[model samples]
Target: MLASPGAEGRADLKLIEEHVQRMRWHVTRSSFADVGQAPAIEQRTGFTEAFLYAAQGFAHGIVAIGRAAITTDNKAYADVLERLHQRGVFLSYLPGTGGPEPT
Candidate 1:
């Protein structure tokens, strides 16, 4: 995750999308939005670096969450997802509580 301010930020979404696409993981806005936006608080005091830092930190968390998902079972998935979202690491798709049925 590359964090850019102003002009730099303009390319962030596209760059992220391109990276995922190149890996053959199509990026949907839903997924990206789920990633959330870097907070604008940095702009308040010419401290834009804060936003980038937050973004980078969140990116690391997202990576860790993905790793957990790949290594754990379904029961653990919801736990990780919840933790990530609470920590502001990643976004989630919310629906009714019931999940997929056995195929």
Candidate 2:
């Protein structure tokens, strides 16, 4: 399914909430740079932002645990997605790629 605004960042989370299932994988609509390039906002000590990337996929769902925060720590979003994907939990998009491989 396609991702909505602020939906991509927490796509898996939202899907879990609605469907009570797990998101096996999804190709990222936007790259890590893309998400980082999204407008940054002020945090208590830093700046950050959150955006969602889209991907084509089969059956899945999500559940957001918290809010999206803008941050200068560009690696945070990518890191979370990467760790999850590497562990065979979630997947992110890549340019000109079909999608991420299941871990």
Candidate 3:
């Protein structure tokens, strides 16, 4: 998950963890990036690392509060979804977080 910065970001991380646990998924790794940074996935170190980790087959899914945690750019978000789909990795959003319902 990509957290913003500061206290709220920390809280978000904690919330994500709780949500993941409730869904019976284990968090083997995590990453954070400031939302203030460029929305491009390549420009965010933490987001990039998370993607790489997933690509390497270390994780089965990436969980976040919403799609915005990945990127605000529609193109970038679609690209991310495609890449994750290619890797057979899933992206999950916390319940009632305004993202698509978990499948």
Candidate 4:
């Protein structure tokens, strides 16, 4: 038996929502930068602005990835998606990727 198109679409949407929720949880659980993990500028008084900038870039990357995921043969967006994904992978290996929120 074959699933209806509507049912398949709903399943896809549900999966996407689950992925979004997981990403949100990870973002919320992470600190902007853990103590001694940030550069001098960020450590002293630059955290808010720095985090805002990083968040902006991350949001843009998400949009790029979503676009690429739905587009066919879109090289530019696909490259952006890979770069953003690679950055996240690299960060996962960093020493302070997760910890209590910075003070």
Candidate 5:
């Protein structure tokens, strides 16, 4: 995820939405690329980059949730953390995995 401005500021949901949209487009387009087309190179690279960005975002989000958990007693944050945990993002980076790993 991009470094947010200020420690305690509102999140830009629009930015997050755009990121999701971009990633979706990259994957969709890349999946349709043929073996040896000029556009295939671009599409494949975009897909790889988008996936890497998403993985990074998940890792950063987990860290933020932990910090929020200790610094405050917000039930909303707890709920969010639970949802994230349920999605298996917490353990998404175990042993061997395909594609780019989270940093």
Candidate 6:
């Protein structure tokens, strides 16, 4: 799981844990960004670690509050999608977490 630092981020992580549990998915690891860090993957150590862990075949997917939790940059998000696709991993979100609401 990935989230920004602070109480809200912690809560988001908890929600992700619950979601994963509900789905019966095992969580091999979790990661979070430092406080005040940009959402870009390159700017977030935790985010990069999560990807690396997945890339290394340690996990089957990445759980996050939402896409914005991963990145808002179009190019960055595309890169992430491609990487996940290449690795046969997935990215999921809690039912009602961050990111723009579904229209």
List TM-scores for all candidates, in order. 0.28, 0.26, 0.83, 0.27, 0.26, 0.80
User: What lDDT does each candidate get?
Assistant: 0.34, 0.33, 0.75, 0.31, 0.30, 0.75
On residues 45-98, what C-alpha lDDT tens digit does candidate 6 reach at each position? Answer: 787888788878888878888877777888988887888888887888877656
Cα deviation in Å at residue 34, candidate 6? 3.8
For candidate 3, the per-residue lDDT at 68 reads 70
Per-residue accuracy of model 5 over 4-60 as CA lDDT, tens digit each: 234321242233334445544221211111122223322444323433443455232
Task: Report the lDDT tens digits of candidate 1 across residue range 1-103.
Answer: 2233454444554554554555454343322211234233322222222223334563422211122212234655555455545656542111221322110
Q: Per-residue alpha-carbon lDDT of model 4 for 28-93, expressed as tens digits? A: 212222233233332322233323444455422221112212223447435533654554421111
What pairs collide in candidate 6? none
- The TM-score obtained by model 4 is 0.27
Q: Which of the two candidates, 1 or 2, achieves a greater TM-score against the reference?
A: 1
Give the range where candidate 2 is weakest over 10 consecutive residues by summed lDDT.
43-52
Q: Report the alpha-carbon TM-score of model 1 versus the true structure.
A: 0.28
Q: Report the lDDT of model 3 for residue 72.
A: 78
After superposing candidate 5 on the true structure, give the runs of residues whose Cα lies further than 4 Å from its correct spot.
6-61, 69-73, 91-103
TM-score of 2: 0.26
**Number of colliding residue pairs in model 2:** 21
Worst 10 residues of 4 by lDDT: 94-103
Q: Candidate 3: where is the Cα deviation over 4 Å?
A: none
Whole-model lDDT, model 4? 0.31
